[model samples]
Target chain A: MANQPSIHAGVRALARLKKRRRSEAIFRAFGIAAIVFAMCALAWLLGSIIGTGYKAFYQHSLTLEVELTESILAPNGSRDPDTLRRANYRRIMQEAMFTRFPDIEGLSSADQRAAKRQNFDIMSTSGGPNYIRQMVFKDPAMVGQTITVRIPTSDIVDQYLKGNLNVDVPEVQRKISDRQIAWVKTLRQSGEIKAGFNKRLLFSTDSRDPELAGIASSFVGSLMTMFVTFLLAFPVGVGAAIWLDEFAPKNKAVDFIEININNLAAVPSIVFGLLGLAVLLNWAGMPRSAPIVGGIVLALRTFPTIIIATRSALRAVPPSIRDGALSVGASHVQAVFHHKLPMAAPGILTGSIIGMAQALGETAPLLMIGMVAFLTEIPSSLTEPATALPVQIYLWSDSAEQAWSERTSAAIIILLMVLVTMNGIAIWLRSRLEKRW
Target chain B: MTENTSKNIKFTCRDVRVSYSGKEAVKGIDIEIADRSVTAFIGPSGCGKSSFLRVFNRMNDTIPGCAVTGDIRMDGEDIYAPGLDPVLLRARVGMVFQKPNPFPKSIYDNVAYGPRIHGLAESKADLDEIVHNSLKRAGLWDEVKDRLKDSGTGLSGGQQQRLVIARAIAVSPEVILMDEPASALDPIATAKLEVLIEELKEKFCIVIVTHSMAQAARISQKTAFFHMGDLVEYDETDQIFTNPAELRTQDYIMGRTG
Candidate 1:
């Protein structure tokens, strides 16, 4: 110990002083600063999203009272074929609103005459109103009828309510008249003009306009895609993993397969999308925008992750357990599934959930497969055109309107919530399985 | 495989050779394990004692790239015959590992697993009885009576080892192969297992592999000494412990050494 260099060695001591404390402290400070910077950025993004998206929960609409007639809906009443189709939803919708709000039945003669208004309600749907569009266009008399309609306010009106409008706002640029503003106040006092939950937002058909768009059309698409991924990926992934981990002999072929699977798991999602488009959508001639095609794409992406996690779990089972099972008359399959697999369940389930969540939130591959199409109606089948939440967020975000920006942030919040929920479920399952230990 | 076959016939091996990927881990050998007796193989590290024990039930088949050849028979029938099902063979000959490998399951479930798989229990109540008797034979029932549903892995190391033995016995196998079953146990646990092994030999043939020469000398009626893939000596445990024949066995006994 005495042979070691002392602190009194002039230039060396100064260098040691700098090395011993300052450099390490500086590095630690840098690390802490980086962490704080990252946290701040995340907080800012979340804060702004929450602030803007909270407005999407409420919407502005105009309500008017007018009579609805059968001729407006079933024009030329002799049509047995058109009635066989779904009822004319638009004519029925106006009739329903008029029945609820009877004050708008008479025409206004003077400018000062106050018209009755109510908080408007509509079974708002998404892209291309399926039954309503067919009904409205089918009847010519429906166009000139004075039936009351509860219509979605424009983006400029929506902005005004969200506090984007000010007192200094120009008269020409203003979306609503002073009378319209007075009616909005009257509706507000009557408990009709405020923001409320948009229930159909997640399950309705698309509207031609953004005012009517909802996530429902896309939710069904996501469900179909996820179902496909679950059906295809779970069995194939787990089986391949069990065979590889428990039965297959140690060989170069298996080694190659393992490496390939690992690499496949890391392949970019967009690359998978392109593959799906070229192979599934074009060559195989599957439905262009079907959720089935989206599922196939996601399954290809999800399998590698499931296989890796499953293999590792199987490997974690002790050799003695295998030997014990074998010695007790359990076949390799019985041993793996009945004995070893039961032990590895927690891990396998965790992997499955992670894979499912990834598939659920995925967008790029779905986009490539045409799941990004502007679908307005709830998906009735796996082969139908639809969009997913993330893609909807992308669609909303790319729009010129600032209102859609808020909607996009709201969609992101929804997606994040879904992800967190799935992860929570996985954790719960893992803990349940781990209780054996 | 015939109906007239004797259940009590002992194992008779001739020129058995075991290899892993072309490397001879156990050289050609001859051995005979008597029925209903405690036969132990004793050797130093890497001397193939555990490998030889695995050969009895073809437990080596579980290992990738491992192969076994030569004759091994029980009840005057070739146990290694071509049509022999490894699963059925294992059912007849059970094993306990060096470390306590109680399944990550309840104590009751652990014992019931083997019987359930073999269809030995005809009903839920019968299954309960099998679990009870197996645990009783392993000498662990009274200690774990209050918590039969608790995980088997929750027991002390000695208790877990006993639970494993209980699981092995639940299937009513004809033979039980123990490979260093108490190697990881403390002195008191080792003594407990040794006494348990003695009691088990009454109903089933007990073959054990051990690194402790003193343990082999203490528990086994016959001891086979293996050295570097070779069976150097086989004799009564007393004789081998007292007066081994081969130079290697003699040197091993005299501590010249392993």
Candidate 2:
């Protein structure tokens, strides 16, 4: 053996080593290229979403003082809430806009009607009427007083003011006429048109007018759906994992069950929606478009992911921990619950959170369950008709309006933020609770 | 076996055998383990010494498809009887493994685990006392007394092994099974463990499986040599090393073959 020549002592060995090093370097370059490509894609996606959607967070509003004509708002002299609510606030708003731009009155009667309608389009259709009604309802004494208030501009004027509309396009091609653009410019010169934080976008419910639309209803629905999903999926998934990993006897039946569970994780999420529609909605007579049903469907979709994650987490715990506990005279139950489960908790929690995040962004199954309904009132209970954030994004993205596109992008940004936050929480929990063996 | 009949017998085995998934590991064997003494089972790897050691406390029951068929009695009680609960039996017979497997908890909790599970200690004070005494007996109290609240996993390998020993001792078991307990330890730790085992045998029946013939000769009173799942020799430690009756045993101890 001592007389044997060393294979590693020559130029051939060095060349072989250099070749191995070069291959490793090439592999590393490929890995880096893949990562760089992924990063570029993500950055481009975020940049486009933010660049188009950030404008939706700020809105142009017209600040004007308009005399509330008592005869128009309270013709019966009855200050009752119902009488005030049913008053002609739209006429009052039109008069207010006409007073702001008096040139519309000089046009011919046939042209004057068109000019008045164009002038009225400068103010938000819903915001002005809702604001005046709320004011009159809150205080009947203010019927004759001139109130200075900030009212949201119509969606077209808002787009024009925010530099989103193409003024270079012919007046016939643009949604906003050149006359309405002049009125917006006059308001801007007088400091009456100001851009401020779009509180309506976050505070109000869904509206036909994009200027008045907000995420409040869909956000609430998402919260409720996620709450139900977590409540149902976590305990059941973890319990099933624990039973299968620690207690179930190793046999053909158990193996078959495990294989089915793994296969269930690979099943398309829409299948769970169909199952929910069949079992939970149709057979159970559950309410449609309700968060409870949506949550149940999402729970069905999420639990399989959670189960796979939890089983892997439980498996990651070294068997020696079980042996250690067992050798100390602990029963199998105690050994698992006291030692193995605690050790597996971090991994399980990370898996559950990731599952929940996936469920939050899910839209197709929700579409099957009728969660795509346009909900205007924020859901007050789990059974109320509701639209989740992803569903809202889907609904808005399908709308045939330029304004809805930006709102859709804004909703996407919000959904991405929520997913990122959930992933952050998952990472934090894994780091905080993970124990070194 | 006849010479040890004068001492109190803790375990009596008749035609003991172990198999994993229908594959025989430990062939039929008959043996008696004396109480309050160190008995060492020495062999090369896969000789079934570790598998046989696990049968004492029914640790083999935890492994899937591993079966032990034997008439094993402890103090005239059939340990393998169907009515016997392994959990209760294990409290009376503790075990330490090859690698230090301390619970990922504080040093104090590691020692208190066995007593807490078996409900041996009546109060926190009693549990603390049990932990202290166990650590002292394991010869680890002085090294870890100041940091009892620190994680057991953070301790050095040697300290971790002693902590595991302390955890086993905290239960006050009548029998202690050590399966190559010092195989992962350095020479100094192994020496310390040998000394601790020497002290432990005065009260507990210590059954150890070791690959080190010198370790067995140094600490054990009775020595059993296993070869190919068979017990080739069982005699006084001195006799087994110096004048083994079987040629296989002689060749193994003399380093002629594994």
Candidate 3:
């Protein structure tokens, strides 16, 4: 400052320097602001998902006791768990509803709508039996008496709790007629029809209506597909990665293979679907719409990703480690599998999870392979036609039913939850591997 | 070649040349390595010591278009013999690199890796025993025994280098090739590695590539001087330093032109 120039040119130079500094600060501020914006978006998405999806995991219902009469249960009171399992729980649930609402004096009369609505199958699916069995086992005396049973409510009632039915809306738009709504108000006052966690969601098969649907078969379908993907993709991907990364000569053929793999990674997931439909379904005559076919398609979708990740993991292993192994008189293969692959395990597992998660959420590709159709019966094998959560969301969204929209949101919530759970597992496994390696 | 007095591994060079396509890297080289103990190859920058080291193991095979024309043998068996599997060759003649490389694995696994691959350890418990004993001989057991399950990469640099030495020892090779094994180390680590080398020479025939003439004089029993891709001198380490036969070797030892 003491040596500062008095000339006009020197003054102008100082002014320019200050302007540059101001611009840089502005640039930095914008950069930081952009980062903050991105973080805010991510937090909002996660919060909204957790908020809406939490409801799909639970249900609200009433506990009304209907006597387990001899005609209803064993047709003769044979009280065996296996026999109870075989004896249709659906029928038991239906009869309980009819028995409770015997006041529905006439079936066709609009006057007894309240009594008819009392009959909802809340305890009929596989998990529903667990509650029934518990009650039956806990006190055998309650079997023939008016023991309280938690029966499900109508979809209209569920919508009210789910915020789908706006309270301020006029009676015409709401499914629950104003009279029944007033009755529900009375029940709410009496401490009967309050919203609570639905426990029967996990074991129910997908319904024609999402409000009443369960995910039993779809859950089974996902497990089977993952089993198949794991069996087919993991070993094959790892084997190819090891060979390509460590053993293969840098010849033209290998170069071609590397290029093809990169190209394969870019191929759209729908293209994979077309290939699956043509090969597995049309020409091969394999089981149509089976989880096996869906899995094969998803495996194809996942294979390149696994291979690329494994190769990088293998490469990240320092060449010195390979030298150390070989210097110890280990063969090339020995140096790699015994030394390199195990070192690369954390990377490989992370890749595998990302691949599996992608496959689990994939819909368009599986859709072409016919895994998005009606699947009522529980699957015995991978051959059974089934829908995954993503496919279910897709199917529900396309329907004209207003209730199906809620189902779509519910499906989205479930799918997002599974994704979150998968990512959580990946983080857990990565931490475990990191601690050891 | 057969009538030569020394019963050592000799590299018979008749106009030996190494080239990358058209450009020659190693012009010509000729030398005989003694049968046992430690032999150090000392050279200046770009003198081709590392390139020469790779010629012995044929590690240059990984590089495309890298050509070598020379007859190098072990007990008269041509190392470059057709149908000689590099994979099998590597097992008999092991190598350690400049930087210590421990796999991202437990200390136990790092040492066990080699013995496992060569089928030296028959069972898991047997393998564990080998890794334990190897680490002990490398002067690292006391420091690392309590944390064998911790990743080898988690060790200090010197400890990691020692762990690598243990890994090299685990395979139980007859010859050990080290390419500047302590160059990337601190002084203490270097001293430890040098001490370990002296102990290792008793059982394994060792060859080391180094740039430090002082280190070469300190560790090796015999020293070979390499200059511009040629072996300038080979003699006892003390003799080579005190009285070199070649002018280049004399200049290098005296710090004149090197």
**Whose TM-score is greatest here?**
2
lDDT of 1 by residue, B1-258 (tens): 011212355899899888988898899889888788788898788888888889988888777778888898887779878898978888889899988888788899889888888899889999999989999999999999899999888999999999989998998989999998998999999999999998998888989998888888887878899988999999788889887788899999888878
Model 3 chain A weakest 10-residue run by lDDT = A118-127
TM-score of chain B of 2: 0.97
List candidate 1 stretches off by more than 4 Å. Answer: A1-37, A61-152, A166-192, B1-9, B254-256
Better of 2 and 3 by TM-score: 2
Q: After superposition, how far is residue B109 of candidate 2 from its true place, in Å?
A: 1.0
How does model 3 score by TM-score?
0.81
True contacts kept of 3: 0.70
lDDT of 3 by residue, A1-437 (tens): 76876565676878988999999999999999999999999889867755665666565666656565546556667776665555554555556656644645665677565445443432224334445656665555555666676656666666665666776878777566665565566556776766676544566677664555766777777778877877788888888888888778879999999999878888999999999999989999988888898888888888888999898877777777666666666667776777777778888888888888888888888889888766665687888777777876777678865455655666677777788898888888777774332
Highest-scoring model, DockQ? 2
- Candidate 2 on B1-258: residue-level lDDT in tens? 213423899999998899999998999879999998899999888998999999999999999999999799999999989999999899899999999999999999999999998889999999999999999999999999999999999998888988998999999899999998998999998989899998998889999999899899898889999988888899988899888999999999999988
- Arranged by lDDT with the best first, the candidates are 2, 1, 3
- How would you encode candidate 3's per-residue C-alpha lDDT over B138-196 as one tens digit per residue? 88999999999998989988888889878877877667788988888899989988998
**Per-residue alpha-carbon lDDT of model 1 for A21-80, expressed as tens digits?**
988999999999999999999999889999988777677764544443556545566445
Candidate 1 vs candidate 3: which has greater lDDT?
A: 1
